[model samples]
Target: MTGSLETFLSTAEVHDAVFSLRPDYRAMLVVADGFDAGPSDAASEDALQAGEAAARAALRDRPVTEVPHVAAWREAYRAFGAKPQRTRNSLEAMMRRAEAGLPRINRLTDLYNAVSVLHQVPVGGEDLDRYRGAPRLVRATGEEPFDTVADGAAVVEHPEVGEVVWCDEAGVTCRRWNWRQATRTQLSEATTSALFILDALGPMSDEALDAATDDLTDRLTRLGPDVSVSSRLLAQ
Candidate 1:
């Protein structure tokens, strides 16, 4: 874990081609090690409740796409040949689901998802132990492997050419930008060290992203006294 964390510290980045497509793109990577990973408890539930309330208030009598950050992500998806209406970004999807209820997967995942909605940003939480190397945001060439489950059976899929993806040495960890995550690296109760990716566009200012990141960091830090957290913001 120490070696991988160090690799992530020096190697995570957004490729130039991705920046060429959306120069205003930004990604904040937050890594936490030695967390007390466990099931969602009172704190996480409270955060989720607050996030759901915030989403409802923000979307009052308006469509989810009208949100500034969500609108920006919509354009980004289209820029990469994906129809945002069909394949919604993580933020928009979470906003849409807020009205019903957000799933409580684990403390780590729940906390990040809550912060994501609370700040109106797209957030991805991954199990650090599952990664083979540093993570990078880039435009896929249709050759990277993306592991997922289909019909309750494990399977592999490939991204469309020019599609935006987050990958490591193993393969694509997230496909279509933030629309979906590879099952292999998803956070679970067994996860102790974790990596969180907060995706942002021009519509979402750096201050707002940092606020969200800070909220998440604070929450993670409270999980245990020995939790160690670090973060870096990548922009071009």
Candidate 2:
């Protein structure tokens, strides 16, 4: 599937408006194929457990808002007119749930979610095969359709005008930045090839983001033999 890999290399675009909104923003796009994919196994379970421990250590006795990276995401959310409290970023939401427990979605999703919490970054994984075009980050015009599940049924929603979102030619893949992912492209047990997005802001250094990326790559490599992975760093 050289063509598939090339599609990922098409250079994901970050709209000028999005960059202007937060000059410190950066994203790491990771694509992996030929790896074993299925429901959460022992390896993923252990990773989730370790990630939970790391999150607890980071939180210690502090509130989620006090975490530096989380605070940065909160500020980013506010910059786009989103209420951080009412609609939390993925990173903040994961950390808050760490005390209770993170969900065991699937091997790919679980591992990425663990890496997200372990390194204090917001990581989103999607079925690469489901994507129709190169991913792009932009300020939504409130017209893009976002397919999602609500109340145990399928539904379509739109983002508020001027909100930050990740989308493809199909529609919005993620809404309100990293707050939520669309069901249309979400990872599942049947997925063998996947795309992972690691979101970061000013508070997280390049080194920190790389560490998280490395951690994820390493874990994915160990899942099975012949796992091929590629990554690209998107920044201003």
Q: List the candidate 1 regions with Cα displacement exceeding 4 Å.
A: 4-7
* Tens-digit lDDT string for candidate 1 (46-157): 9999999999999998899999999999999999999998999999999999999998888999999999999999999999888888898989989999999999999999
The weakest ten consecutive residues by lDDT in model 1 span 1-10
* lDDT by residue for model 2 (1-236), tens: 33666567566889899999999999899999989898999999999999999999988989989999999999999999999999999999999999999998899989998999999999998888888788999999999999999999999999999999999999999998899999999988988888899999998999999999999999989877989888989999
lDDT of 2: 0.91
lDDT (Cα, 0-100) at 93 in candidate 1: 97
Instruction: State the local distance difference test value for candidate 1.
Output: 0.92
Flag regions of model 2 displaced more than 4 Å: 1-7
